[model samples]
Target: MSSQVIENHRANAEIYSGAPICIEKSRQLLDEISMPKGLLPLDDLVEVGYNRAAGFVWLRQSKSKQHRFNRIGKTVSYDKEVTAFVENRRMKKLTGVKSKELLIWVTISEIFIDESNPDSITFASSTGISRTFPVSAFELEEDGKK
Candidate 1:
């Protein structure tokens, strides 16, 4: 998808708390934001955030007096940047418990996203071929305890 589309999606998502925004609208916003004025990069001027899902792009930024000067530009390639950022964050020696928690949370989210529409039950390979259980089984157990 075009960078403009991504920018609009971000703006709408941020403004409405995750509501989908059209590419056209995002492009317009990006164009408006990216214009240079006195100095500073638009992103630096405000808190910029982005989320990418396949072809779709979502972006958000903090509102400021220099909102007009804020340029919401899309990266030509997000994967490389994202990978590098993740790696750098992971490699930071200072990150301890928080890093571990972040890794776990990211892993869980990735698993859920990748395993969309998982079957209710899953089989296990074992000598006895033990019966497998579904996620629902665990939920049921938790509910029972409650």
Candidate 2:
């Protein structure tokens, strides 16, 4: 895919409701969307959104233009920047009403539950952050979450 193709896709989506875009529109689309030069810097990922129900991840560059991709349940392919971004956003700070921490926008495999203790779960982020928590402490909510 060429820069022209990406521009065209962006234009086309803008004409519509900006509904989620598929990562595999075609092989050509994938080639075009991939980082042209090198890795996609973490700072370049301006806004990352996930939809758990639809299993879609929306990525926007710093300029606010957005693109969506089908999320793989296992390790993310292509770039670690996205994986890191997703991991960071997945960790939710403990709130007053909620005793357990909520993990938003994560795949089942990305989290592990201790068989010996159903209440205990282990989480590790792409950046190497890991922790264990109670199952009740985490929730998966994915609706326009960044």
Candidate 3:
């Protein structure tokens, strides 16, 4: 193959393997979860992988735990920041704007972290409405109730 062809092949392989594909799949899953009737029990999900052999995605609860759930059809559109916010919330990881799942259809306009209580996060909706959530409910990775 020519040098340009070899470079293109490597680029495509990179896009289809490892972190990039996993992150994109995670983002797609989060977008699906943001829609109505899109309740995904993600508190137990640690890693998600796309199965090229089976033509499906698999979600792993932990290093030694696994389970399967059916897929949903709806998807919600979100900006990059909101997508990262949702991903962090699903992973129960702390970010600058810590929060939990709020309204499904509304877009988040602003995030406010309560200094008095690091456990609380306030979110302003795109429609000018605000809501707060307690991060205490989601601080643990194994709080699988959702």
Candidate 4:
């Protein structure tokens, strides 16, 4: 399937801790957790996890925000470019189902840092697929033997 890419900034760092987390970490966590990775403008997707019961969650990146500057006592506006999206795909089917059914696909429409808290980020997918799943759910069979 074709994909699109979008640029975002909030997902780059922790809003509260101000700790920088790489995109790779975000991807790893999403895969390990079996969270639905949302689709982007350029065939890109983001994996996300959440625990509604405990109010715990994680995301790959933060949202973009406008930056205001004071120039000669005047306010100027700019934007931060911390997160970005691009087309990506697996080189081959990691599963052994020999059919598309074995291949799990998810679409994500938007991703942004929580407006209330910069450290917290949220990823939203237009589809209704749930994000509360264990990482084992998406694991491909080892040695191509399912």
Candidate 5:
């Protein structure tokens, strides 16, 4: 992230630090934006910042982590810092996330849920390749609720 942008947002953003609350706040932000809470599933989040006016959000973790979406048998890597411009059902200009395909890892630039379909989410890579998967694949069953 650019220093100027970070400074500006920090001045106007809702900043959440510390592990426990950052985890909750991150999940809450996803819920508010119509995204699956488990979509991020970051570990040991150190900080999170959201600039609602600019739709910019960022997550900082203690270290890089990789998570596997068992439903799709795909793995995604999250850097220590992840940033994006987010809106309802969509995250654009994403940074710090990559998905492994075969032997290559591709940088995912955008993720969106199409209104017409809604049951699926599309991930577009910076390389221009895109893939769509069931939305439920990313949704988590919070607290074991049905």
Candidate 6:
């Protein structure tokens, strides 16, 4: 998101700065929204913020990063700043994220878990294409996390 937008969001928003707290806040937001804790996997996070009333969240990092999820064998890219509107069991209107498929890098627009399919998560691209994967695949087995 642009600096103007971020500045506006900072008003009454719950904001965390620095890697340690930013990582913790990022993971907590995922957990709160029913997403796998490691779904983001951003590096060197500089700030994390959430405006509850607007249901907006943003994460800023030192630089862009490309991560290959070994479990899914797919490369995903995270831009310097990421933003989304989050709700329980869902995240929509996502920006600054993309996933590679074959030779194309598709923009991911939404991610959600169906109430009827509790074990899986679906990622929808801006092109309206989507794919489902096991929720466990994105889970991070980190210390102090069950």
CA-lDDT, candidates in order: 0.24, 0.30, 0.36, 0.27, 0.90, 0.90
Error of 6 at 99 (Å): 0.2
Model 5: CA > 4 A from native = 2-4, 143-145
In model 4, the worst 10-residue window by lDDT is 91-100
lDDT for residue 1 in candidate 6, whole number 0-100: 37
**Candidate 3: tens digits of C-alpha lDDT, residues 13-94:** 3223344445455546544533111223333344444333222333333222111222212232321121122322232211
Q: Put down candidate 5 lDDT per residue, 100-130, tens digits, no spaces.
A: 9999999999999999999999999877999
Sliding window of 10 residues with minimal summed lDDT for model 2: 92-101
lDDT per residue as tens, model 2, 115-139: 5665565565444455565443322
lDDT of 1 by residue, 80-132 (tens): 11100011101111111110122331111110101443433222222223222
Error of 4 at 103 (Å): 7.0
Winning candidate number (TM-score): 5
Candidates sorted on lDDT, descending = 5, 6, 3, 2, 4, 1
State the weakest 10-residue window (summed lDDT) of model 5. Answer: 1-10
TM-score list, all predictions: 0.17, 0.23, 0.31, 0.21, 0.94, 0.93
Model 3 residue runs over 4 Å out of place are: 1-17, 20-104, 143-146
> 89, model 5: CA deviation in Å?
0.5
Q: Candidate 4, after superposition: displacement of residue 52 in Å? A: 36
Q: What TM-score should be assigned to candidate 4?
A: 0.21
3 against 4, candidate with superior lDDT? 3
**What TM-score would candidate 6 get against the native?**
0.93
Give the number of the best model, judged by lDDT: 5
